[model samples]
Target: MNSTGRRARILVTVIAGVLLAALATATVLIARRNADPAPGGGADPVAAASPGAGRPGGPGLRVLSNGLLSTVSLADPAGPRTVTEQHCDRAYTAGGTTACLTPAGALSAPRLLVLDEGLRVKRSVSLAGLPNRTRVSPDGRMAGWTLFVGGDSYAGGGFSTRTGILDTRTGEVIGSLEEFAVFRDGKRYRAADINVWGVTFAADSNRFYATVSSGGVRSLAEGDVAARTLRTLADNVECPSLSPDGTRIAFKQAVGADPGKGWRLTVYDLATGRRTESAETRSVDDQAAWLDDRTLAYGLQRGDGTNDVWTVPADGGGEPRVLVQGANSPAVLPAAR
Candidate 1:
């Protein structure tokens, strides 16, 4: 590996550490998904851009190429990659909109960019903290992000997070989900230490699901974007990702309700309230993405900090396989119909 390759690999390593540290053992029931903190934390070395690098909005898998925005055909994920100028710590696309979280830099603060289907920035907002996770609504009207604001790891209960929401249509931005009113068991619930993250919006764009932690309990909370309210639905659900059909949620549940024991990838049936464990039994820590109604995709880090995008049967059958290599964040772009 040359200088750029070495840097990219090292980034892969640091990013893995960032993810692990972001949700290590003995946590505060924190919510958020994945860790793809930029290439160099603050700044990145110049990338060796290749010929034929172009726009990445076609039906494909959009991912970070050592922190550079890149894409690969869903049919041939291991094939040639189309690189873009966008550099982000975390990225996600939904309903023709892309959310890019730039890393907080030494000279420049981190920011969020809302982009159109053409990958053109429609809006950009300055932000604070380490970019942890980001998701756009299915209709592309809403976007949310999570940041590691304080401390390094959750193992010592030393980490904190700030999650925010943005309404692209109205140019409205909620700096933190903490501003919203939370309710549990049909009453207003308030805690001195409340954190919310990993927002997965519903089709209506007005309603969404996210992990809301209060009183050291993480619950899968449903939110009303218009009312700025979140109602607890279930407990011990972190980084909830609502399925495409809206009938199920893919989340990470800590082993034996202990974060130190690591988390197991599980799916919950909304209508039935039954849980199904995914086939990949490793200590998965990132928020999962639904490939369809029956398949799930997420980033998994190796012991050495190398990362890869993996997929498995969401129905709790079959085995897990690497969908893309040398990638941490995986967002599936709708294949051109």
Candidate 2:
């Protein structure tokens, strides 16, 4: 062959090699993308595109997608969440009421919001301290919230919580449960060091349960709203959440009655007066919600301060499982509760 013909063959060979290398690189990239690990442990669901801010939330599992109010389907708890524009440090919904606790700022105090199903704020009450937990009564006629009123950390044993309730139907606010008279040991209980948190209401709205701490001891107190009274039921019970059936209450019991040692998720039978520890075996500093009468769901913080929701059996039988990733303050809606 002549010199010109040899040069043309060399140019074609170099072009073919370049195309082959590009094709191989593209294939490897696609494979790596497909194999990417999920957010926590299980498979991460592909997040749905943001529907923009302030979308209405309906029936499903209500959660905080980051700090915004969001919802995920109960049929698919680990699926993509539908985020909203509303921001809250904690949130809950049931019956027809949706309660949200807004994050506090340097210049502004935290606020509690009662939003409609369309994500519109119906009523808002300015609150003091950091937003901690909130719950709506089964009948949706009442709402309650807990705030870190004093100290910096709960585990440090210097913290105090203020829990309050609202009569949503009458627009009457019980600013703090402290105003209610509580009886201990069959006598009137009044103490300067009383602190209350984690209010969970029964189906009747007038009855509820909470963790009442006074003089360094915490007990589960059953409160009567009309009478403005509280009756101590059990000791070492913190953050009580009533089950749908009214037969059991789930709470985080301080491990060995010591706050520094962590807590065990426990369920108390109202009739039998028996407490059953859950299988989670991890410290859950949260007010658990019932996913029906048999299962309970609560938040567990990752090492980085991010959160993932986990579920365990109420009867203390099954192992713990991750229900939703990057979410907290779970509320199962009308269909279940």
User: Which structure among the candidates has the greatest TM-score?
Assistant: 1
Task: Write model 2 residue lDDT over 232-257, tens digit each, in one string.
Answer: 98899999999999989999998989
Clashing pairs in 2: 54-85
User: Distance (Å) between predicted and true CA of 69, model 1?
Assistant: 0.9
TM-score for all models, in order of appearance: 0.82, 0.81
Clashing pairs in 1: none
lDDT of 1 by residue, 28-79 (tens): 3322212323322432222443212332444677888788778788878888
lDDT scores of the candidates, listed in order: 0.81, 0.83
Q: What lDDT does candidate 2 reach at residue 198?
A: 92
Which ranges of candidate 2 are over 4 A from the true structure? 1-59, 335-337
Cα-based lDDT at residue 256, candidate 1 = 85
Candidate number achieving the greatest lDDT relative to the actual structure: 2
